[model samples]
Target: MTAPFPPSRPSPTTLIGGHVLVAGGLATGGLKYAADIEAEVVQVFVTNPRGWALTDGKPSEDTALRESPLPVFIHTPYLVNVGSPNAEVLEKSLGSIRHALRRGVEVGALGVVVHTGSSVTQSREDALRQIHDHLLPVLDEIPDDGPDLLLEPMAGQANMLCATVQDLGPYLETLEFHPRANVCLDTCHAFAAGHDLAAPGGVKAMMDALHAIAPGRLKLLHANDSKDPCGSGRDRHENIGAGLIGAAAFGELLGHPAAAGIPLCIETPGKVEGHRNDILLLKRLRDELA
Candidate 1:
């Protein structure tokens, strides 16, 4: 088989990389896998992904990451749902984010990723209000140099606050456009949410919409090909270039003017080898696409 990557190193300025949640410890596993892929940017979970635990057990690992030149991002536990109407769940969600932000700071993360969670019981307005009520205090507490709180839009599931990129405007407005609030655009989720990344000029169109909503606030990119067709509303993540969205769509995405400096992290389904290949593929495309 041909090598996926040539000997050339990827540019750290673009910060394109992957989500490395390996079998062993997060602190070591994430960095090792990233190095293997020549990834400049990496996303990792500080604690268990499925649970509400906010503790980081490896201080040495965190210190290593904090001291490293690689920029790190932390994905909050899936259980964090600040939009929940349930008071207990709301409290837990707020606590989870609060803790995650602090951990991000300690680990020298550029940002902490949180999903734009669903609103089950209340109307969208009420849900936004609840989020505002709970999150404002948390934002108030964040130090100026703390990592940004990046909101990742979901696959347009029912009652999701930020179902589309445009939907982020209201949330940011509610937060009074706090400087620390930024965005993470997920390609698969964007496709599933009815943004046509596969169509011609679609990537540019999406960038235009995002720029209109919050100018220059897109801090992270979750680069993944979608498993299902567009508008499927599913969150399945396929590897780069192997899914319905295809390779050309990502080429267009990389070449777009608005995507110039944003960090691209592949959240595609993969082990270390798979991700390394994917990263190499993206790097090759980035060169040719540019």
Candidate 2:
């Protein structure tokens, strides 16, 4: 189906991708899936996404990923909530991030992306303090060659720390403006947070805000179409051109300077076939709009 909004003037510089599942119980299944969809970049979980357990990747799997030409990214497990109040959960969250960083190195990943989790039961102030106290040491220990720690802003569900572009300030400050810190802006999350990416000049305005916050820190884009409307605060993701944000918004995003030369991975529904089609659809929008 054609997108509801006007097709954006596209650019040939963007490299779109998908959140490929590690199919067939193979850690390299994500790479295979990316290849199947002709994706230039790929994102995957180095271990079970829902659990805290960190997998010791096999030599063969590590070797295969290193040999691949794709720009791979490792997403820290969902169980990580670095802002959690509970001591145990907080410790695990910190450990999980460190583990993801180490794993990213082993797999030759470009970055390790983690959500800016909510500050449940704590004020934003307190959460920022905790994040600083715990994560500062970890960031200090990062080698000069370690993959960047990219923060993915979430939909402004209650207590979300980095809901808008301006909200990233405290986190950046807390990291003492660490050079390795970067952003992974998600279209659906920004739309859900009421950024209006589908509206005229909306993408530019959003980029302006991000530029004001931290120039050149937008290292990745989660190119999702929100199933929910602007300001709905829902995290539902829909396929390309098939949701509230529409395909044109994605094209708009691709056209923005902030998105050039980075991986735009769709975290939409469906696996292999769905992701394959979505990748093709994005590429079509990019080329046709250009």
Candidate 3:
């Protein structure tokens, strides 16, 4: 163990990470499964792995999970496309959002993460309208104790509206989502989407942009590296500091003015050793760069 936490005063939380406990993808018991497999905390999909209709999970099941100091998070199903223009897709998307919020409560999760999907060639105004119309209502249904939602912008690919974090600005502004409606910036997605967070001022620029939109709404970070060039619009996630985005970028990310104390989650390849290596690397950066 990393020595009983060293008993220091808790610092103010920000975008950077501090001893992150990456949640494993749901292959079995969802969050409980990850918890059992040596996860400090975990994130899981509470539904049919690849379906629109979310499965109704029981709350008592979450109550029976193994005890730990780590907090759990829920990742909404990938089938949800909140930015879709088709009526059927739109309805399903909205329903999926509601289901994710509700399921998050059942599992005693900290929050749920939703991808800021594209508008599918629909007018930009209409796309924004759809988000304001369908998404905000789900946020309203959530009670104070319910798990809040975290909006994640995807890599900007052809036909996708939200390819960068900046693309989510309008959606965030239009929604009545809880104050906890935070951002989850994926390193690979952000880098591939456009923002180069590896240069000297790159991290500063990213922090500035993130702060400009939500101020303090950045909740979690999908700590990953990219395999393509900057602005490639590819979503390939490589091991930390090993791909297109160099190690210095992470140094900037882990040691940024804005990124100081957030739960940096790892969604990289491999399970035990992959996560272990990344976590140790991040910890080393925090120590050397912080």
Candidate 4:
């Protein structure tokens, strides 16, 4: 549209001028159509949502999946309750994450996105320790072929581990700072978590915090618009511009210095209109910023 985004100001660390990868592939055709549109990246769920479970698949697609020219990512199963207080649930959670990561690797995906989840019980410190204990060893076992672990922070509520960008530091620190582990900040969730990403300097503030906490581990952005107001802890995602955060903030985000080179995965609702409209809006804003 704008003659290939002329190299101008310090372009955002994010992969600039590119459309966000639509959120789901397994349950929707949007993923398939998106690929044909020349999208450079994509994010998808390899299993059932809302829990730590997986959907069955054919063996042949594994090679083609991994080899696809698109830079790909995997959304972990929702059922995998990493913070569950019950030992049985904890076991299931570990298995779920492991299986999900393995599936992502087999499919040739680059990363597996996990919620900066919280405790099913009220034990905050215990949950954090359990998380470090449960996750660290499993991470070490990941082969070179395994997909990267991209921890997406949740809204600050109750016993959440990654409410703020800085909170992830301790957990990550406990792990000895593995190279393949990183973060994916969701725009809506950040707002819901009480970070005003819409205000001037907010985006950069979060970026600075992320850098200070995780250093080079910031890898992706879940560019979602929130339905609820800032600080609400709700999980509703609205269409890009129509939402409370407003679409223009995406410009702030994409224009920020820290977003460089990472994919912005859109977890918005509505189909192609949902993603395409946001993509169009983002490109326009990006051009304006450019």
Top candidate on lDDT is: 1
Off by over 4 Å in 3: 1-39, 58-60, 176-180
Question: Candidate 4 residues 1-290, lDDT tens each?
Answer: 11222344434323321233334433234346555443456776676666655566446556655666667787776666677788887797777778778888777777888876778665778787777788888888778888888888888778787777777877677566777778888888899988887787777788777766776677778888889998898878987888888876887777665665667767778755656676666656656765
TM-score of 2: 0.93
Please report, in order, the local distance difference test score of every candidate based on alpha carbons.
0.83, 0.83, 0.69, 0.71
Query: For model 1, how does the per-residue alpha-carbon lDDT over 86-119 read when each residue is reduced to its tens digit?
Result: 9888888888898889998888999999997988
CA error at residue 200 for candidate 3, angstroms: 2.3
How would you encode candidate 3's per-residue C-alpha lDDT over 207-286 as one tens digit per residue?
A: 67777666768777778878888888899888787888877777677665455566677777666566667766766676
1 or 3, greater by lDDT: 1
Query: What are the clash counts of all predictions, listed in order?
Result: 0, 1, 3, 12
lDDT (C-alpha) at residue 188 in model 2: 89
Cα displacement (angstroms), candidate 1, residue 235, comes to 0.6
Better of 3 and 4 by TM-score: 4
Supply the TM-score for candidate 1: 0.93
Candidate numbers, best TM-score first, in rank order: 2, 1, 4, 3
Q: Put down candidate 2 lDDT per residue, 76-192, tens digits, no spaces.
A: 888888888888999989888999899888888888899988888988889899988888888887787789999988899998888878788788998888888899998889999
Ranking by lDDT: 1, 2, 4, 3
Pick the winner on TM-score between candidates 1 and 3: 1
- What TM-score number comes out for model 3? 0.84
Off by over 4 Å in 1: 1-13
